[model samples]
Target: MTTKKYSRLKNSFICFIATTLLILNGCKTNPPNAPDDTTDLGKVFISANVLGAVIWLNGNDTGKITPDTIEAKTGMHEISLTKDLYYKSTENVEIIKDTTIDLHVTMEEILDIGKVYVTSNISGATIFLDDEDTGKLTPDTIATNSGVHQIRLQRPFYQDLSKEVTIIRDSLITLNFDLVEESLQTTVLLEDFANVSCNPCVASNQIIESLTKYTYGPEKLVAIKYPTNFPSPNDPFYLANSEDCDARMLYYNISFAPTTIVDGILYPISTDSVSVKSAIDQRLQKNPQFRIHVSDNIIGSTYFTTVTIKVENGSGINFSDLVLHTVLTETDIEFATPPGSNGETKFFDVMRVMMPSNAGESLDGISQIEEEVFNRQTEISTSWVTNKLHTIAFIQNVVTSEIYQAGSTIE
Candidate 1:
């Protein structure tokens, strides 16, 4: 072969190999209509109320969290925002090519707002919030908002209570209340031992008449006068019911005339107002252990009396051999003239009859709260005036000789 022919052939083969290498490299670099990034594709901008929320696009991970923009195709895509302590919010969004679509998501917390626990010492009390009935009783739970609120507790026969409390977020607020009991009225009894013939009885009687009309009226004091057979052989008032008069005189151990007893305690039988007022005041200061209520019905000569005794809060009290006495008495007994030599024309609060033979009913000592009711019907004698009659009930401690409480029918 010639030298010129060899050189030319070698150069041509080398040039062809170079051209093939250039074309292969160009094909591997990029294809036609292919882009370096998604510059022309649609974008999805996601914003959420909660931070650090994971974002998903078209059931695929976008590798981007919330408050970010994701490049997507021009079509409908499911966009989701999720977090550990928040509810997942999802929506389908349509993307427009070369444009951004904003997605605003509102996520809800996973926990409740607040809770409240209401309780009271006494069960079955109604609960109220902000003056609105909650329809919930005591020892119950309620779901409410987090803030300041007013709570009220109410029950029958107990004082109502209201209070203000603050509720914390994602926490429980407990409210406990102790109720108070209602107040009850107190009553007292006055026992006067006198004979119409006794002259000193006139002044003593006058003093008692004024006391019965005190500020408290009929509820303040109750008087029962028993006529005695002292200082006169045949006292008309005493002879009217000698059995009861003598029984009372012997029971009180009265050895003189015009003796006055206030709740089984002896008081001076004189016109001195200070001594009488002091004795009555001392009895009124004592707290009564029992409450007495009496009612009566009269039908011709038949008298019906009902006595109710309630042992209220006997927690620290002890009773031994207690007796209940129901006595029928007449008030303002007009004699037109002096019934006896006492010169008193009117006899007030005179003992007419004793129920249950005067021995009284055996009241069992109660160590707790309790009530006892007694009823008696007796035929009234024609000698006693029925229109002015009243029933008096009392509870007495036999061992201590102290009268605990007394009540009566004023009318």
Candidate 2:
């Protein structure tokens, strides 16, 4: 070959080799990359509680809306979502190669809570708002939603009072309840003497129960039924404690199956509602010369009570032989079968025990304005329901057998 032609051919051969090397280099899997290589991408699905929210990634606009999926490099990424009038949501996400991630966000609504105060004539009245029990009593302050609601105050003796209230945001609403007492008079005591075996006692018991159901209260009229042996020899109540029954029987000189005594005066043998109510009305008309207050603390089957008797507006009648009688009574007593021939299945306000003795404690005479206090501690028997027990304390004129004042406590 000629020298010039050989040189050209050699150059062409070099060019061909260079072009082949370039092609091989371009097809290589492992190539030189920048410092922040974002080629390895992952996917993400995002959703939020609010609509029309803008999404941002790594402080830069992703140009994507919520409930949409996006593609990004595999690494830790900062995501933020924002909407008008709602809290902004921020999250940190880690993306993995060939893996998809899901994100959900929720925004909170701003609300202003209000305050409500409920009060009544007596304390411990349960408060209810919009028929929902607040688990609060009278003279209490409660945090409630800001709106109009119905309010109800309920207690044992006092009539339930209801009212409508409107509460504004960040405002206070006060509700006052002048609850009316059920009985129109002060405290009164009713002593009932009966024999459980006597069928007539059932009618008398029904009459007394009817009166007590509407007017019964710790502060109003209270009753105690004595089960005598004549009615039934197997009387459960009489057998439970016979000493108290015998003592009360001797005091009242009771000989009948059903006899009701109001204060100190005995009513006619008729258990008619008119006759019973008449006797009660006469006693209620008279203003009691003294006031009694009873309080108790119960721990398990043991109960401790404190009673105070304060004489007020005494008409200068110096009482002789004033006795403070503390009696324990049980209500809502039930029996699987009738314990006597009376066929009564339920008994209420049955005398259980007398503190000290049925003879009672002697008290000093109150001339005008004086007071007497008594403290008693008693351990209840397991045969009786502790929750159904109560305490009754009264001052009586031993000579007249008249109950001047009385106080009772169920708790």
Candidate 3:
């Protein structure tokens, strides 16, 4: 009786132990939903703009890291940051346990530099400096100070841009600007180009919309809609400007519209960031040299601004047909489908020509000649959110239609 009882007892005890182990193993697999006690409480900073950004740590939102640091747990946490037009970046970060880590980063740019300088293809753009109120373009030397500066250019019909150009101490940068009318910096222009009613164009437009939104997002990026002489009749923006498109095409040697010159300078090899960054890095390596002065004022509801396109040491220059057109635009105008237009239409810089169609009045004898003026009437007309107005002035080659110098003013 003693031996049998002992064996039964042992079997029962073994079974009980096995059940307990199974339960413990299950618990390990699905741990309690609480911050681990052994988790590191160190710091890992976020790299974001002063504007705003949403940061995530370990699949949990660690709140925003605006212009500064983020308090995060240490050692290998998942990090995600998001904003408009920027590519959402996710990374498994390696933070030292209980240590402060600096993760300074420049978020990917979805919008073109909201500020830029443009030169006309033909006309000589006038530059008005705030310090001077009215000054010459080629003192070749307009003095600027540290901090923010206002510069402006004006012309009739074309949208005008007044922008803040920042200057740093002892930063000698020179920018000789050329502006463009009918900006080709938007995705719409590419759609207009690649989606012509012909082989590969229609499909190309669809591809452009999806890809551009994916890459650039919205609000930060836009594609100019450039209709051309290729018989894309359905496109309302389409115009019989073969000479304009052709000359620009030759200068930049661009094969199509899906192509654009970012920051008024370089062209992205294939509209991808990695490809685009290569061009950006090359330019950024060199500090900004010349400062373009742009500013504006309200005159009896007809806002008037002065655009001063100056060059540092700009003397004895002869680039044929450098035309200037000031364009005043109201962005964010939503449209389902414009009458006599194709595709979902969203217009930016809808050309309200303050000047004649030729870009200027004097067709002849306008060369090396410095200043010009163009005016327009600005009254709220459902163009933008009431009181939310922006002016963008671009300079393009009338002969080539290539945009070179551009700047904008927003109020």
Candidate 4:
């Protein structure tokens, strides 16, 4: 063998080695259709029979509604679709890297119904379902479609209550609400027609005052003494407001002084404390159908009185021919000498004036769950003490002669 033959053989072996290295490098490079292992994400196309169903991925809201595409990490994921009035649907899916998967869900409609027993701490509350009045009261069962619903309870003189409840199919749910009552108290009115000149009025007035001030207090009873012209026509209280005094005296058909009227019922003329107390106790047992609030303030020489009347509940009582009477009275009147024939030196709750006449303002249309406000202003009389002035208001049925409620500014 020659030296030239050896050199050519060595060069051929080196060229073959270089060709093999180039082929190996080309095989190591990734192909265009192959997936890159570095990225751990996949695309999911979600759709539902109900187009607006919310999509949840791995128990987290994907912030996307159905019929949309979402990107998620490559792993086993739980997909759920939720829509109102539809049963929730869930499915488990496996996602491959750089792969796209399609998911479709069939939503089921909620056709089953359930019963809810509605009740409250106080009965007679009207039931409302989803803002619609069901025309049903508490302690009644209402059939409703299975779903999430808003329940509301409403009643007169109570704060309305509301709650969100989920009704399960073929199940019964019991809901009870604690109702809050508006602050209200029934007050009795005692109208006593008396004169300072009558000797019997002194004893009657003392008995009435003792009951109204101490025995019953202002919460239970209110008394107004209207000066009468019977025994003494020259009575100073009668002279102050003769028109109202005379009108009230004739309305009740009073024949003499010291006559008492409890509510609108005429009572026998008696100075006995036991008789007066018995009459008042009868009226106190009646529940209040209306709430009366009276307030007064003095501005300049004018006395302003405001009366607010609210119907607390529906008692099925006829409200027709109802009248609201507001009276201005002077209390704790003291004098150095008796003003009339009687030797009485002190008078309390003397009728000063009746606003808008004794006929009273008509409350013809007042009804349940309603409020009426009246503002009346009267000129302050120079003879009456300003600090001792008080206002009293009451609601009465003129036809039946029944007083429903009464209020005063005594406190």
Candidate 5:
């Protein structure tokens, strides 16, 4: 019985050992369709001619410098290497799974590179370097190749500031600009109210033309003539722009033709050369309180005018009820036949149209040392000559009817 029991125990021990060995073998071997335990990735060994170049993989910064190894998923990739003061180097690389590729870049160093810090009295002025826009404003620094460069600053209502700067290699320089404000030129306005049908207007026009065109020229005086309805309502200039013509005539209470108004002062029925010259001379002696600039351009059938007014000195001047009047005049208009009873065919400074309206443009918030720009455009009339068109701008007080300053785009 004892021998049989021992043999049974030995058999049981053998069975247990066989089962344990089978379980151990199942854990050691992998299933047929199981996935891999390790990832399939590639590495890149990157280096540059110059050390310390930043590395970029597929346009993303890898936060790694030169002479480093970077691991990436197996695919195509764009590699970029960049360093300060050196031209960037780029290369396309194909990454194979479980493989490392060596990449060496020959970087070109920029020669004689320098830095410039630019500033202006007034900030935010546009900066131009070597006549090309740098797309940068003032109070900023710029990096460029060392050489001679032209720098300019442009701002509204201020004169452009320019300078030639020499940039030295490996050095920094600062440029400071003390910009000047643009001042207005002193000018006198001659407002003439006359009729083509009035006989005396011929002499008045001749005398005024002599004084304005020859004696003073446009440098000091600008003249504009308003045709009137009196003496004859058939006046072509009057009939063409009657609203403005009559409004100006009534503004000065003009009752007759051949009347001249200088600097908003009426001279009724006086075409005297000596008196008119004296009025213009006296007005010219006054200092310019405001600056007026007038520019005109014609595109197709459109007449455009830009009037820029700057307050040079607002002291002791009435800012309230300030009006800026822009008028388009035909400098010289000749008719084959007399358009009125006066038998006159030639006219100078004849009013064609008032910009915006006959009432003129009212200005607000006019203060000392400030500038305002007004743009007015009108359709050119087919009957009016294009080449003879002129723009005249003036600043006046609506209450006192005193013209402060005047300018024109004659020249």
Candidate 6:
């Protein structure tokens, strides 16, 4: 019986060892849950503005050229950029697990509306902003809200003009006009570039007055009479200012007497309406960066002058170099002419003299004034006035003598 019992125990122990081995083999055959293949993070693409420029990721300079791709972690990443004439910009981005990311940037500069031009047959015509007068119908570079605006035109003895204008993505807009004349406020500078014995000066004055009356009423046009070549004993209103006479011969390099300069340019009797309109209209298309608000104050002896300039900021252009000048005008002075100008008299809004010629400020520039936040200011003063004086101030190029803006005290 003892022998049988020992044999049974040994068999049982063997069975237990066999079962343990089987379980261990089964565990080795099937493993726990885990990923099968290796995963990868995404790449990042960096691109600066349209201008070809360098880009940096974090602090390291990626050898990759612009529009380059760099290795990145699958989560969040920070970026830095550097370029010429531009400020550094930083941005945070999230890179996807398998997809690449693209980024862009923006920049700033000086000068808003580089230039504005307006042209019409009636450039000398009055212009209105909203309901206020904006000097003559010249191409203006005015900085205004990016929206719709009302514009009106008017001239002496002619029909008035009114319209709506839009300022869009571009800073420049050319406003052209086609107009008809009803009345004329024509000023005939009847220059007799002839000898004292010349008799045609008489006929020229008559024609000039007729044109003035046809364009504008009598209150508008002025007739300045002068003799040229040989001095006439009857000379009254003649000054060397006229190119027709000996005094202005060297000044204007002209040797003719029956010549006239309309507005600020030389205009002969032969100029047709189309040519006239074309010439005047061309000036109206130019955009000016600065505007003028002339204020004349009576503070003691000196006339305090304030010229407020409103400049618009945008785009990539900047307008610099500012200079201010003022002119005085007096009209309705009667002068003896060859019969035709009798009682017709003469008038002049003469630019007598410039006030404190050094009022200079950069009208349209990339940066603001040193207070370092916004715009800047400039002004000058003069006490000398003859009561008939009206002031016009403008921003001009000191070397080129080209006026960018014109403002009248009356405006």
Best-fitting candidate, measured by lDDT? 4
Per-model CA lDDT versus the true structure:
0.71, 0.70, 0.42, 0.78, 0.77, 0.43
lDDT of 2 by residue, 1-411 (tens): 142244345556543553453234332222111111236768788899877676767554455778787766789988887554344578999988899889897865436567888888788888987774565888998766577778999764457789988877888877899998544346778888776788888888888877776755555677888776663545667666666776786576555557677876545443677877777777777876676777665542356787867666666554557788999888888878887776888998998888877889887554355445688977656456556778988878888787877778853
lDDT of 5: 0.77
Taking the tens digit of each residue's C-alpha lDDT, what string does model 4 give over 287-314?
A: 8988887767664346788888888775
Off by over 4 Å in 6: 1-277, 299-302, 313-322, 334-344, 357-387, 398-401
For model 5, where is the 10-residue window of minimal lDDT?
27-36
Where in model 2 is the C-alpha error above 4 Å? 1-185, 215-218, 365-371
Candidate 1 lDDT tens digits, 316-351: 544556788899888877767776787878888888
Q: Provide the TM-score for each candidate, comma-separated.
A: 0.54, 0.55, 0.35, 0.56, 0.58, 0.32
Error of 6 at 8 (Å): 99
Leading candidate by TM-score: 5
lDDT tens readout by residue for model 5, 1-411: 242244346556543553354334332232211222344678999998988998877654566899998876678888998676686689999988988889999999889899899999988777887764555899888777788988999765578889999888899999999888765556888888788788889889999888878999887999999977666655666666666776686576555567687888534334678878878888888888887777676643567888888787787866767899999988778778888877888999988778888789887676556567799988766466667889998988989888999989886
Shift of residue 83 alpha carbon in model 4, Å: 60
Which residue pairs in model 2 clash with each other?
A: 197-231
Number of the candidate with higher TM-score, 5 or 6? 5
| Candidate 1 wrong stretches, greater than 4 Å | 1-182, 315-318, 365-367
| Per-model tally of clashing residue pairs | 0, 1, 84, 0, 0, 38
Better of 3 and 5 by TM-score: 5
